[model samples]
Each structure stands twice: as structure tokens, then as C-alpha cells.
Target: MARNDGYEDLGAWSEFGTVSGMVAARTTESLTEAHTGLGDRPDDLDGLPDVTVGVSAAEAIGDLAAELSPPPPKGYDNEVDADGDGTLDDATYRGRADGGVDILVDVDGDGRTDFIGADTDLDNRVDHADYDKDGDGVFEKRMFDDDGDGFLDRSVFLNPGS
Candidate 1:
């Protein structure tokens, strides 16, 4: 038994001796196979085992079917892992049901600054300027020249309610 066992089974050391009747009991399979090879032992008397298999982890749990137990399902909390990085931002692991969090970060301390909503364009742009974005008073917005004519074109507006 020791020769054929692999640690993957984890039964040899768990239940070393005495039949545990576990579904993973390798000894049972071996004994069943050996019965066929008993070969000319006798045709009159009932055949019995010369040795008994050992117990298994399944038997330790008082469940002979433990050996055949399937693995538990691994699930996910989308709200917990919105970023899917397997980590949380802070020690407060409060799993929220919302997709994202809302926070305020004032980089310039102007008393009113929303990083995500700040004007990316510097053309005195508040929200929809294709040129001079970044709000630094510079025309880095690259005036939308879709036709390469160096000018702005049709505006893309947003209906907040929509």
C-alpha cells in the first residue's frame, strides 16, 4: 500500500490502518483487483482478505463518501472586486453594492475641485472644448481638425438627464 500511494490522495497518513470504507480508499480497489488474481486458492470455502486497508481522510470526517467529495465553488463579489486586482484600497473592507465609489480630492485646495470632473482643457473649458483642455490656460485641446483644416467642427453635447 505504501508503494502505490501518492501524497495527492492524502489518505495514507490520515487513516493509516483499518478499513475506512472511504470512496478514495485505494486499498479497496487493490483488494478488489487482487481478488481476481487469488488464483486457485480454493473453490469450496469463502474467500477473505489476508490484510485490511487503512483509514482515509473521508473516514476521519465520519463520512465514507468524503473521498469522493468535489471541491467547493469559488465565487466573486463584483462590488468587492470592481478593479479585479484582488485587493481593497483601505483597511475598511466594506464591500459596497455599488460599482464605484464617489470621493472628493482637492489638488489645488480651491475649495471646489473634482478631479474626475475638472476641465481637462485649458481653453477656459468647463466640459466640452476640443482645444486648450487641461484648464492651464493653454490650448492643448488640439482644436478638433477632423478635416485637417485646423479648426473646430460639430460639437458633441451631453444631455445629463439622458
Candidate 2:
């Protein structure tokens, strides 16, 4: 008889809508161990881990998740006519979990952002920003948080064509 590589067993088990109880138990234990290795309290996904060792695992996970997630889709949480131009020139959007905020300005009433400022760490400071500094639609100046430490640590200027 050929050696059973477990695929045959898995296919057989799939017809029953569930794995065997023993397999399920082992799977659960493996998953629990993996979560524990990540410093997470497997029983409570939302609960912070015990931090006697150092930083809580939950905080680390949150920071990583925030960095990995895409920026909030382009939309304004608040709008105001900051330039007395009788049109909404300023738009702001608050970060979902980090309390950060993004501010966008539509300087020419084109419904497109001409300037962008963001506080990625919710520290009441702008950590990243872009500006169309020359009255052009293109953002020529950029401030970025190179270390993810909620500080704008780098600035870049781009030419018109590049």
C-alpha cells in the first residue's frame, strides 16, 4: 500500500464537513501556540498581552497594522472655505484607529487635493505632508516619517517633470 500522505485522509474528512476531533484539537493547540509566540493572549484577541517583559503585544500589532493598511480612501470628514473663495478649500479626515488626521486642500476648486497634511500618530503634529508649492496641481514638496515614529524626519522636493 502507498504511504498515506494525509492528503487522502484530508479529502476523506472533507466530505464530513469537519476534521476529526483529534485533528481539530491538535490544530487548535498549534494555533494557540502560534498566537502565544506572537505575545498575544489567544483567549482574548482584543485584550492586551501581559507586558512585564516589555511593550504590550497588542500595541505592537496595532502599530504594524496601522503602517501596513492603506491610507483612508480619499474623502473628507470636514470641509471649510478657508480662503474666502466661497468654495470648500479645506478637507480633513480622521484616522480610524490611531486618532490621526489627514488634511487636504483643494486650492483651485478642481475637486482634487492640491496640498496634503497628515498626522499619522495622532500626536497633534504633522508627520507627513505634501504641497503643490508652486500653484501647480502637482505636489512638489513632501514630508515623510521615515522611522514610523510619528515625526516628520525627511523632506523631498521634486521637479515639475519628475
Candidate 3:
């Protein structure tokens, strides 16, 4: 027998139907650990497409179902309170499904994210990030961590393409 490799999103619209994908695992443990959110909770399939209803109504019900569902496991492992107001102002998402980590920070607890860092290699270190200085919503510049040392070593101003 051959060892199973892993699974990834195959994109929308396939012969398998919507909300469907291939799972190439022989054991239940492998299927549960695959980042498909199967281990999170049991979904009643209320979001499935209903041909009897109009598209807008079906969409509304699906949105409601999504809102009522619980979040996935290991979604956010790290959190920070920037202003000491007893509320989490920032969070770091160690993505198991996307296979990367993203750190979002709101420096002053003003409810606006001022900085974002991305770890593309899943090494717990940011490779690049966009920064919003002066509390504005627009990201003014970008920084890069060339050595994966958790310290941004390079900076560049954003100007359209560069």
C-alpha cells in the first residue's frame, strides 16, 4: 500500500459537487487531522443548496448557518492587548488550513489594525508585512524579514507597483 500524501482545496465547481473534495486517507486519524474542519463540529448541512427556494433566500439561510457555527480549532494561538483595556486588540493566526501564519496588530487599541505580518513558510517568523503608520487605515509601507529571525530587516515605501 502507498502512504497518503495530504489534501488541499481543489477550487470551486467540480464533478464532486459544491462543498466537496477528495480525501486520500486510509485511517480516521488522518482524515480528522487534514485541515478540512471536519473535526471541529458536526454540520447539519443546512447550508446545502435548496433548489426549491430562490437564490437570495437560500443564501440568507446559509449565511445564518455560518454565523451560528463555531470557529475552527487552532485558529488563533496568540493574542495581544495593545492598550491594556482588558480587550484583545490584536491576534496571530497560525493557519493550519492555509499552512501559514499571520499576525495582525492594532497598536493603540483603537479597533483599527495598523500592522500585519505574514509567515509564508509556517516557521513562526514573519517573512513580510504591511504597516499602517499614523493610525490610518491605509498601509503606507512594507517590511521584510530576510533571515526569518522575527526581526524585520528591510523596509520599502509603497508606490503603486513597487
TM of each candidate vs. truth: 0.14, 0.33, 0.43
Model 1, which residues run further than 4 Å from truth?
A: 1-97, 117-162
Model 2 global lDDT (CA atoms, 0 to 1): 0.60
Candidate 1's TM-score reads 0.14
Clashing pairs in 3: none
- What candidate 3 gets wrong by more than 4 Å, as runs, is 1-89, 92-98, 160-162
Candidate 3 deviation (Cα RMSD): 22.2
Flag regions of model 2 displaced more than 4 Å: 1-89, 94-99, 144-154, 159-161
C-alpha positional error of residue 140 in candidate 3 after TM-score superposition, expressed in Å: 0.7
Clash totals for all models, in order? 11, 0, 0
Question: Could you give the C-alpha RMSD of every candidate to the true structure, in order shown?
Answer: 27.0, 16.5, 22.2
Write one digit per residue (lDDT tens) for candidate 2, span 1-162: 222554554455464545477687788877844544567436756677555665455446535755765565454344434343666555645354555666666666654566667765555455677867655456688978777764567878866458
Give a tens-digit lDDT track for model 1, residues 1-162.
Answer: 344555444556655544455654776676745545657756545565443366433234423232434322223121211122565222111111232222112223333221221122222212222222233322232223244332344444223243
Per TM-score, the best of the predicted structures is 3
